[model samples]
Target chain A: MSGTSAPATAHGPHHAGPYNPAKGRLGMWLFICTEVLLFGGLFLLYAVYRYRYAEAFHAASGLLDRLFGTANTIVLITSSLTVVLAIFEFERGKPTRARNYLLFTLLCGLAFLVIKSFEWGAKFEHGLYPNAPHLMSMGFGEILYFGLYFTMTGLHAIHVIVGMSVLFVAWRRIGKGTLMRTRPAFLENGGLFWHLVDVIWIFLFPLFYLIS
Target chain B: MAETAAHAGAYGEGPYFNPETVKPGPAGWLTTTNHKRIGVMYLSLIATFFSVAVILGLLMRIELMYPGQQIMSAKVFNAMFTLHGVIQIFLVVIPGIPTIFGNFSLPTLIGANDMAFPKLNLFTFYLFVAGAALAIGSCFTGGGAPDTGWTFYVPFSLKTAVNVPLATFAVFVLGMSSILTGVNIVSTVHTLRAPGMDFGKMPLSVWGLYSTAWVQILATPIIGITMLLIVVERIFGIGVFDPTKGGDPLLYQHLFWIYSHPAVYIMILPAMGIMSDLFPVFSRKNIFGYKMIAFSSLAIASVGSLVWGHHMYVNGQSDTAGIIFSLLTFLVAVPSAIKVVNWLATMYKGSIRVEAPFLYALSFVWLFTIGGLTGMFLGGLSTDVPLHDTYFVVGHFHYIIFGGTGFGIFAALYYWFPKLTGRMYEKRFAIVAWLTTFVGFNVFYFPYFVMGWQGMPRRYFDFPAKFTELQVVSSIGSYIMVIGIAMIIGNLLRGAKKGEKAPDNPWQGATLDWSLPSPAPLENWDVPPTVTRGPYEFNHSEDDK
Candidate 1:
């Protein structure tokens, strides 16, 4: 790392190109580290409530549809693969193929969101969301479980949308040929982020749906 | 870019202020990627917020003068202290040493031209400004400033009519700035060191920031999420921590302390690093137990995180958890004690300079020791039962934060002044200011330790008539301390533009920074330097000077 990185400083200030794509990996990984902890915080909250109200959490988990959870999991995981393939193709000098792969990633993102909203809507129609009339009508443990359920999933959905937006931009820029091998950090980082969003859903799927 | 015509040195090398800026004045400042200018920008912002907090503190002191509605109503007093805490913690201290000195010197110390992410560095500064503006704006916007205290303990924070969502959101913004800065600095150190400068040979100040950057990266996110939750609870009516909705209020505390405890190390570790650098220069000797002092920084950062439960001891953490936390808390003291001992050992049997920075360093050793010893009292569950929220806790806090980190900052300013400006402040005024601040500080805060032990609770707008004498003394001391601070700041500001040119190699330091121009070159060096030995090898630098 030192051998490779120190040369930028050695180049002196005027010509020292500090924005090499490799350094972007360090920055993006650090950012991804923070994102994991951001969700890690909610995970902690879930763990605490899960410990305190194991039976109630199990009961509440039954309310969420395993079929929708399974479908969204497949869509999100497939989206991550497409993002990686997009980057893979871009690195291989196949911009056209990369754009196609990124387009698929965005489509998968949309499908996952559509599936997630349907799942949420089914619960909402039954008044099972946080502070809902029916959820409040249930036991305190159930209220706690569904409260965490919506918060975690709601937060995850927001990340999915953000990831799709990033990839969408990358797809357009790739089509425009603005990205180059020397500085493809933008798409590379976007792919890492898309993977994280998918990975978080992977955790969310089993934690909520499989618990039942 | 050529607007300044203020080349840095005799050879007319780099631009004096900013290298990439296209405009002269404020526009140049706003777009600058120069770490020195960014450091100055942070200084300017911190000075503004510190004054506001100090004034709020003095007003609180005035209200406590005779204890019975001396100046303000109880409700107003609550708002004042809350504002003070919010401004001081998020605005002034959390971004304290590392933002100011680390930005200014870290690149130069490691012989890099600038931070690895210079544009991102400027972005963080602007982000900090926006966050600070949001925090300041919250004082007037919704229901007036929040009165739920800085901790913003849940249920109350949820229930408060005062504007908490805006304050929490402001904190969230500030946390984003802190996290990005951590990313930038960590990358700067990892990738931008001089040719031969490995981790071991790097200055303790860099190590201090390196350790602190990790803490900032790891711990700050937790606070960011927690603060976001506060905003979420208020805006979305989430019952995540509302006890009436089956949520536990204790969870709020657990989450708050998780980040906040590590934050104390964030505040002090850099200040400790400044001392590690200062002791070697003043004493003209190799730093004693250099590796121990360096590793202690990392040790302190690690152990500091585990002890957050200690803050919750009286708040009803289980006895087992409290015991575990208490033991971990004591473990932190070991590394801290190692640092203090090593500092004194470095000064032993050497030719000591006793300059302004060294004087402050000496003061830091004793005052911080007092703060640390008193912390031992509060860390124990048995003794803490009495002192948890009393004036004693308040006194102990002021000693550690104000006496310790605050003095550490003053010492650094004095030490770095010549290097930053190519000039020197009046030594006589510096001495006088330190004396007044020291005497006034002791007189001001010492009474709180005594009054608190006698059972005077903190944050009270009124107190018993029997405690009148101590309160009067404290208020008087606050006045003196404020005057002293003004003098110290006045002297430095005066020195920057008008003081005599800095003597060639004033401190005779061995680090790479000391080898550079007094107000160092804009890019620090045309070619990055090569390191050959440890940071404190003063044996060789004497002849070079």
Candidate 2:
């Protein structure tokens, strides 16, 4: 790492743009690396609990909507593709095409959220919310299992919403010619983040939907 | 923008004290991309929090003057300790180096014009402020400040009377700020090095921060997510940590410590970096084992992460897990020993000067040695079981955190004060403050180590009269230490205008920071610097003057 401080003696301050866009993108990618570790830590917690209370987790997983989670996973992965394609459009100097791709990605993000709301609604209707009165009534393991699932997946959904908003803003910026030149780092970084969101869902799909 | 105007040299430059030099009040400070300004802003916030927490600490001391709830109710005492922990950990110590000195000096030391992302740097400062606001604001909410202690142990945290969710939310935001700053610095170090300054050629301070930044990036997220989970548990009644709904409170401790223990390294590694810089400069010698010190930082960061379970030895961790944690915990001490030995060896046979920063660094060595050795005593399961959560653990950490990290901060402040403010503080005043602080610090925390060994539990308002004498001495010592703190602040504030002028390189140090004027120009460097002499080249210069 370059020392964060300035050199003691040098000719003049301004150098040819110390801000390299590619490195900027790389910095964001590195940020997601940490985010992955963070989520990985939480996932480890889930895994250990699942191992310890496999019957409970499995039964709890049965309560979650398998079709809804699978559908949302597909929606997110599809959005991830569009984001990549949008970056590709920008790389090829096709701003209009990139805008269309970004729009599609944003739409997919919104759709995923919409489906998530539906799933949450179902859970709420079924008294499956976290720490619901019926939680302990079901059994200790089952309550613990559902608790981890809701906390993990709910937090993941919040991130998706945040990711979607960032992308929507980037989409508008691209159309305004702000991102047309030099391939917007915003679009690139946003794509990386969207992909992370997708990757989290990929893990979530099996844990919440497929395993049971 | 206007690069030329910002790049003027010594006589060619404008007046030494430009009206524009000090950031223009609140708005200028809020929007400042200037690292020095941001450093000052962070220090100001830290000081504010420190003052509040210190008052709370003093009150806790007074409450313990008798035995059972003398001045306040048990509930209030709980809040006091909780406030003290939260303020010290989240508000002050965690941001100790990086936000203050790291922000101000990191870009300057590297011979860069500014941080790789100046705007993002500003955002970090703002984020910290916002988080602090949220955290402190929770105190006034209907439910009152959180009483979960800084650890926010689950079950209690989720079921506490306080508005813990809001407090946890604040912690979440503050954590993000820390992670972002870490990422920014890592990238800055990666992308913005001056020419000829490769990884091995960098200064020790940079090395320390680089390791710290990685810890912040990697470990902070676990804590962030953990805090978020607590909030979720509280708000939505998630059973993740709630005992009634199959949640295990033990899991919360595991997750919390996973980040929190590594966090202890985050707090001290940069300070160690500060000592690494101060030791050689004040000693007027080459560092003893430059690579060892650099690599030990990484060692501490990695090994530190694996030892969080040590905190749980007495808290009900499985014996196998405890053994693994104990082994890893012992491993951490080796790197710490390497650092201690290397620093002492650096001072041997060297032309050492007793400057204020050097005094603090020396104290850091002496006190951190005490802290580290005592830690070895506790690392063994036999001793820890008896003394866990007693005054011993409290004293052990204070020695490390206060004696180690706190002294390191003072050393850094004295070392870089001139660079940040363009003024030389009173040497005698600084020295006097250091003496009292060093003496009072030992007097204060040393007894706790003894009382802890004697089986005095921590956080109790009243104890047996047998422990009273030491408690009284510790309380008196606390006052002396506070006075010392007051003197240090007084010297800095009074010296800002009344002090003498500092040369660009007052210590004649060889680091890149000495190459620039104090209160560096709007832009950092005229051009990126090239490295010629190695980081440890005290003997290379024949002209000592």
| Candidate 2, residue A190: how far the Cα is off, in Å | 0.8
Candidate 2 stretches with Cα past 4 Å from truth are A1-16, A133-136, B1-25, B68-70, B539-544
A120: Cα error in model 2, Å: 2.0
Give TM-scores for every candidate, taking all chains together and pairing residue i with residue i: 0.96, 0.95
Model 2 docking category: acceptable
**Global Cα RMSD, each model:** 3.1, 3.2
Chain A TM-scores in order? 0.93, 0.89
The interface RMSD for candidate 1 is 2.7
Report backbone clashes per prediction: 0, 22
Q: How would you encode candidate 2's per-residue C-alpha lDDT over A1-212 as one tens digit per residue? A: 23343422343433323436755775797689778977886788788778888887777777887788878888888889999999998888888898899899988988998898898888878887665676657887777667777777777888898898889988889777776556478888888888999998898789877665
lDDT string, candidate 2, B319-343, tens digits:
9998888999999999999999999
Using DockQ as the measure, the top candidate is 1
